[model samples]
Target chain A: MDAVLSIRDLAVEFKTDTGLTRALVDVGFDVPRGEVTAIVGESGSGKSVTANCIMRLIQPPGRIVAGTIEFAPERALSSEGQAPRAPRLRAPPFDIVSLPNRDPRLQELHGGLISMVFQEPMTALSPVYTVGNQVAEAILCHRDVSRRQAWRESAEMLERVGLDDIERRMRMYPFEFSGGMRQRVVIAMALVCHPEVLICDEPTTALDVTIQAEILTLIKDLQRDLGNSVIFITHDLGVVAQIADQVVVMYQGRVLEIGTVRQVLKDPVHPYTRGLLAAIPGLAPKGQPLATIGSVVGDADIETPHPLRRLADGRQVSMPQDSRG
Target chain B: MRSYLVSRVLGMVPTLAVISVIIFTVIQLPEGDIVSSTLDRLQAQGVDVTEEYVQNLRAQYNLDKPLVLQYFYWAGNFLTGDMGYSYLFSRPVNELVWERLGYTLSITVSALFFTWIVALPIGIYSAVRQYSIGDYVMTSIALVGLATPPFLLALIFMHIGFEWFGVSTGGLFSPEFEDAAWSWARFADLLAHLWLPMIIVGMGSAAFTMRILRANLLDELNKPYVVTARAKGVPPAKLVLKYPVRIAINPFISNIGLMLPGLVSGEALVSLVMGLPTIGPLLLQSLLNQDMFLAGSLLMWLAILTVVGILLSDLLLAWVDPRIRFE
Candidate 1:
């Protein structure tokens, strides 16, 4: 019920030499407080675009055409019914989309109130700097702590992220770490300031199955411990089932279905959503041919407006107009 | 790090040895040694060619020895700092080389500094601004600098100095200070004339380095790490400098090895045109007159400098980038 980020009618467009192409259109979702909201989609499904829009990090030629990404940090930060911690920015909910790129308020919110864990842990970190230096830099960016204090805090954060020998590991470069270890360091960097909302953009997609499972567990455990909202963008249904409290299925830059994990996974209404569930490899009978979804949604289907119909179970599914009629 | 340094220094020995063999063979490949060229000059000057005198000259200079033995004698003496005699200059090769080396080093070193100082900021600006008017203008100027040869630029500066400043800038010193003792005034005169050749020799390299840096920085600017830094709310200036620029500067550091030899040889034409007393022209003269020891020693020194420069650059590269260091 309590939403930390309420994005409404978000639209983003990329200007290519060919013409303007829609990256996202009429996309809206709420990331509730102190819960994992997994956004599932195939590649090019605007999952990353939504994440970038939330952070206001869309580069040139890709601009948010319309949206209100309302971030109420006060609600997210104080939801535990205790006094808010230090480094808290006490402000009313503000539209992140409307804020200028260099607005001091928006910058303060970045890496402090709303931080991101990028997809590629290998390249997401600077190679030249030591892990300790980078993590401390994140702390120093948001909080007015002494350099020594920041290093100490960074060491503790690294320890918290399941890294062994924090002292020695901190001095090592990112390239020195394994993929899973680098992802852990990245998580430490993201959560160093104890941000209210952590946007993880496919954090485990690059790791092996075992490491992926470990990282997912680590994230879930940390989320439970830290009590911060997490927007987990992933295409793996298994991962969404394992970690997500709520689910948002996106296709062609549009949110087709949004509901609680059980509601959407067990009782999905949209044909596209049903096709996605059927395409899961595990659900197919062993030794039989894996059932594949035919092309059920087309360009015309996306272009046509399909109003979201709320089912009795509180799941919202957008059905094609012809099927609904 | 210490082992790396030691191994690198030790590695240069075999490289220099192979190079020395090549240099000796190549220099010998040209017909006749320094003695014949000296005798030809003498004969051209109407000096009578006597058999006894010729035999004495051959025995004294070891001209009659086998080529392998000749190579050993020269190489053996070279290792002991006995750079053999210069038949053309009629002086010890060491004296002639050492004299010019000081001036050569001063010009090359200062020009290197000049190139870095002029190129780095402009390169950073061009990359950061990318397509802005300032970037376009800087790029145009850099292209022009790249296109113009150093000798022509030297000639242009000479004419400008003579016509506009009412001062001749053909050498490293004014006429009065040409052979004078070192003094504040002589140094001042040297400084005034120095800029012309420095700019002439440095322009092409500075333009090249700037374009390299700009392109490297442009590539780094789009990397995921740069975007990560930006997403971390790093301010634009600090983000650019601390992240992308640091990585972009690796190529420049790696280029130090190539740059040293390039600047030394590149200064040759400019030095010839300007008539500055540097090794370029000296090397040129020794090579032309078949002065074996002098030419061979100069080439050897150039090889040594190249090896040392590469070693220094590798060390600096490792120091600047931890990835290279750990590897």
Candidate 2:
């Protein structure tokens, strides 16, 4: 499959009062074009950091030490050197790392070609602004439309995100909405620009299971209609099973395995991957203790609070240092 | 909205009444009655002052009554536009305050305006470009402003004005415009000497507000929504103003209450040093002399202003923060 975003030797570190903690080290992956690529990891395993780095949203004290995120354009631009507003046209491939923050190419890609839907939609929106204003802001950021037109288009997008009372929802603040509604508004804000790639950072983690399923369905539906690629990050294996076409399992900031959903789930290659599969609740036999990976194989000198839980099963699975399988 | 306003405004009545009683009682706390003090002053001035005269004045002014009844009499006269009298000024307290009100207002307003205008951008910049050289300089200057006494600053500026410029910057206007009508020259003259007191009065508030705004904005900048906005390709400037700043300015809105009361009452020491003809000095003098009606009335008016300030701030908060659905 043709890849839209190919990351190479992606390294990230966080500077703290104590010392530098490796957040992402030698991590790499290729997101197939027009497919949902889910990056799965436990908290503090750098799943969110990878997404933030792609958006260049990593603040000071946390830096992308080394990496190249190359986004491949699906099609060519017209002779005018101008991007077509229609989703039919493809954006040129972007070097997300090397480009200056103020670069027009980056601005064009961000919110226009690349957008992110964050976890905790409650805090992901400014409470002072009406949902319409925020959506309009996203549209007006890239598109050369009048404020009224942006509002009109944004309201349409809000309706597209499955919000029933579009007019009322648009006028209300984020604080006024239910968790589901706010998440939908966030999705609307991200998708309003018709971004080619939507990076969802645990978008459904903060919600209930039912809401999570609905959001997952909405994302799938939007992807089907819009034909944009998605990079969904979450620790929930169940969600990955339902939505993802390809899965990337991460352990302590390193990619353990990458393959199709059936390949990874039916026959997981990495020991950590198999452990994750075993850790899934309600799947194990009713009588026996659930299987779990106890400890890592190698990495003794690299000392810190390890992200993966040490299980009572006592079995350990570590990355084979020589192989890149 | 109407209910919010009505509740806030009506709530002031009880507050003001409580303040009025407190101010009157406190003013009366100084040793000896106002009548005996009057006679003592007369005796010191070489008049044949007598006990009978003191007793007559005390009975006449109803100073012989209980403290609560005295407060009622004073409040009644006050409500009727007679702010009793300023014994020190040999004039009615209303006349004294009204005569000086405009001068005090100009100085206070100018100081407040300068404080906000200067502090806001500097605070924002320091927060945005935190750890940069300009931010460091601004922070250091803010510290200086916070630490240095305003009166000392007033004195320094006054001395420099007289010594270096050979022009005294003590009063709000030159001798020519002391009693001049509203002319461009008098206005310009007032503006000329306005800087010293404005700086003295404004410096601490500017520094304090800067620190608050910087901390507030820094906090908002770290929020996930700000990241969402930035990811939305919201330009740096608009992203800040549209999202983070709007959210950050919540507690800052309440500061309007703090600013409003200070704008009218004036900073007492700074006013004394600059000799800017503001009410701070007059009110202080009245309080010191135990001029009960004058001091009580001034304090009561300030309390009323404070309550109005709080109400106005509450209204502004409701307007800015949509989450505040006032019942």
Candidate 3:
């Protein structure tokens, strides 16, 4: 299978007054085309940071130290014989770490190829502008559309995201909309460009359970229609079980396991993965007390006498990834 | 909405009445009485001044009545738009003050326009480039502007202009102002004379305004929405202008209400230093010689400006931002 996006040996570091704090280390994973890939990890496990790195959103003092992120060149038109095409050929799978931020190809990747939906819907929108105007603004910025066409497209997108009274609500400010509506508006904005990849950073964490279900379902349906890869970042195993086809378990900043949902669920490989599965109360055997993972998250020390080393069985037995990374 | 407007206008009535009463009562005070000043001046000139002559002079000026009665008489004429005569200027109070009001407003308003134009971008840029050397230098200049008073700044500007730019310190227009047609050259001359006063007042207030805007923009930049926009793959320039500036500038627009009073007060001081015929020098002269009508007329104008300024700000808030509903 062709991997749409592949990340290898991805390490991220942040400079602080104390010292360099490694946020992500040796992170490796691949997202195939038209699939929902879930990065399952608790907060501070660099789940959000990994997504941000993909979108080039890491602020100052935090940066990708070493990594290779290769994305397939998005084909604008199928080559029929030797017909002439646009002068700018699509960017081939290149190391995102080495790409200059201001490069023209990099510029095209942003907002054009990848769009992000943040967790909090209320804070994600421009408060001064009407919800409709803001979505239309994003469309106008990315697409070659007239103002009238942009507005119409924005309204249709809002409706597609399951918003009721899209026209009336479009004129309303974010404060006027409910939490679910705001999230829908955000989704509409991100999907309006019909990007090749959509990175949802804890998209449903702040939402209530019912709204969470709706948002997740809407995202799944949108993905099916748009045929774009979705990277879902969340810590809840339940959410991963419901929506994720392939799961990448991250402990601290390292990927612990990468496999199909059933493989990881039925036969967990890593000890940490086993512990996480055992810790789930409902997943335990009937009438028996729920087993709890003994080790605390983020408790691993990086400077201990010995790091986790491979065992003789060739099983690579070691402590879980260090949270201090 | 109509009721709200009516209530706001009605509230101003009591305030205006109180202000008028205070002005009228203070002018009718026994110390430095109109009759006494006239009699003293006549005696000093070696003319035989009598109580009857002084009393007749008081009657002509309507200073013979009780303070309350005289206040009503003046208030009655005032509501009818009769500002009475200015004993000092020898012209009608409204005529003299209104004529100068145009000149004062022209310079003060132009300076205010410049202040916003210069401050908004500078302040936003400084905040966006926070901790950079450019930000540091801009902030330092703003602090200096804040530290110097408008009049003092005006004095310095006047000195500099006279010494270096060969700019005139007196008159908005040149000596041939009456003869000159309304041409670009004439307008340019008027603006040249305005430079010293404009810089003095504009820089003083614009510094504070810039600081306020910078603080506001910085606060907005820290907001999660701005981060969201950046993470959404919006270009840096678009992200800064669309989300940060649009959000941060709301508070600054709201603050226009407070800035109005400062504008009126600053106009006086800036006009005084520039030797422009604005309410500042006019009010100053009235206060020195105790010309009550001139002072009262100017004070009322200031009060009116305060009300109008706040109303304009509210309307602008509505126009620029749809989130704010008047109801």
Candidate 4:
């Protein structure tokens, strides 16, 4: 599979007054080109941090101590196409870690080459800006267009995102729209620039159960239509099974399993993966409480001391390919 | 928009009416008034203090009437622009007030203008570089600004001005310009003398405003939308102005109602120290001497500013914050 992005031996730490706490250690994953790569981990497993790190959006007190996020050459990224244009991509991958926070290169990539959709739609949108203004602003940031043109394009994007009555809705604010509609607006903004990679940081976690399905379908449909790679960060195993082409199970900032969704779900290897799969109630026997990770690994085992540091010191422990695959 | 303006203007009537009653009644609620004080002053000067003369004076001044009747009499004449006579100045209250009002507005409004112009950029910079050395220095200066009293600052500036510039540092205009006719030279002299007082009055308020803006902007800068905006490749300056500035300014804009009242009485104590012929000290003197018309009219003006300021702030908030789909 063509890797659009590669994260190698990623280690990040948060320095508080008390001491340093490792948030992500020896975390590595490849987001395959034109596919949804799901990183499933509970809160504090650094799934969200991984996405933020890719965008170089990590703020103070938390720093990426060791890692290199290599983004594929921009030449391969088409400005416009149904499928990503198959041009000969000759330029070397850009090292995202080395770029300064406000470097023009990084700014160009952000919202232009690589965009992100956040989890909470309520706070994600600025209250002072209209739906159309925000989307148009994103376009105006990267594409040099007059305000009128940007707005027209934004309206088209809104219509594309399943928001009808475009002209009126464009002028409306976030509070005017329902949660589902707001999320769609955010989606339109992220896709407006036709970014090559869209980071979905638990995009539907704050959504209603019914609306969540619609958003997920919308994202999948858009990814297909736009031909952009997606890094879907979530803790829902069911969501992973449904949406992800490749799955990476992370626990305590360490990658436990990485393979196709079917391989990991049907024939799991890692003990943590087995426990997580078994914890699903549907897979359990009838007339009994669901088996949980705490039951399988025990409470003490889940917090296994330095499970991340056990392998090659400061080197990636990329798992082998399955013979079945 | 028209309805909003109509409602706001319509809303001011009852408010001003209530304030008028309170203004008249509160002055009387106090034990002694202009007559008693005048009587006291007369007796202190060893003049013949007589019940008969006191009765005559009270009757002449309409003080013998009921409080409600007194209020109606004052309100009736006031509504017709005859703002009673200021016995203290021996002139009509309307003439006394409007004359002093120009001097007061020049200082207070300029102070306000200076405050906003200086405070906004400093506040923005402090928030953007929070915890940096520049932020620390700016924060320290803002704290000093807040802690130092405006009157104390005025006194210090006066001493410095006299010692350094050999110029008398009190009042709105230089000696030659005080009663000079409106001329280029007089205007120039006023400009030379006006800045010191403006700085003294404005420094305290500007620093206060800066700190508020800084704290509020810091809170907003860390918000999700700010990060989202940054992610959209928005330049750093535009990102800050677009998202955090607009949100942070809600509190600042809301403060306009309070600040507008300050335009009248912002540095009453400071203006007193500077000996500037502003209305603030005049308001105090009128209250002390029980110059009912002058004090009441001034108080009414303040109330009007407050009501109007609040209405303006609400309208401005609706304009700035798109979230308010004001029906």
Give me the displacement of residue A215 in model 1, in angstroms. Answer: 1.0
In order, candidate lDDTs are 0.87, 0.81, 0.77, 0.83
| Per-model C-alpha RMSD | 3.2, 4.5, 4.5, 4.0
Descending-DockQ candidate ranking: 2, 4, 1, 3
Runs in model 4 lying further than 4 Å from the true structure: A74-90, A283-287, A298-325, B30-60, B262-266, B325-327
Best model per TM-score = 1
lDDT of 1 by residue, B1-327 (tens): 888888888989999999999999999898887668768888999999898888889887888899889889989999999999998888999999986887787788788889999999999999988999999999999999999988999899889888999977787887888889989999898888788788888999999999999999999998988877777767788888999999998988988888988899889889999899999999999999898889999999989988998888889999999988533
Off by over 4 Å in 2: A75-80, A83-91, A283-287, A295-325, B49-56, B64-66, B259-266
Off by over 4 Å in 3: A77-91, A281-325, B1-30, B165-167, B178-188
lDDT of 2 at B163: 91
Q: How high is the TM-score of chain A in each model?
A: 0.91, 0.87, 0.84, 0.88
Encode model 2's per-residue lDDT on A146-230: one tens digit a residue.
9999999998999988998888878888899999889999999999978878999999989998999999999999999999999
List the pairs of residues colliding in candidate 2.
none
For model 2 the local lDDT of residue B54 reads 74
TM-score of each: 0.93, 0.92, 0.89, 0.92
- The window of 10 residues in a row where model 3 chain A has the poorest summed lDDT is A77-86
TM-score of candidate 3 against the unseen true structure: 0.89
For model 3, the DockQ equals 0.48
- Report fnat for all candidates as fractions from 0 to 1: 0.60, 0.90, 0.48, 0.84
Candidate 3 lDDT over A56-141, as tens digits, reads: 77877898989888877454422212222234455446766677878655554565567888899878888888888888877776
CAPRI-style class, candidate 4: medium
Candidate 2 positional error at B228, Å:
0.8
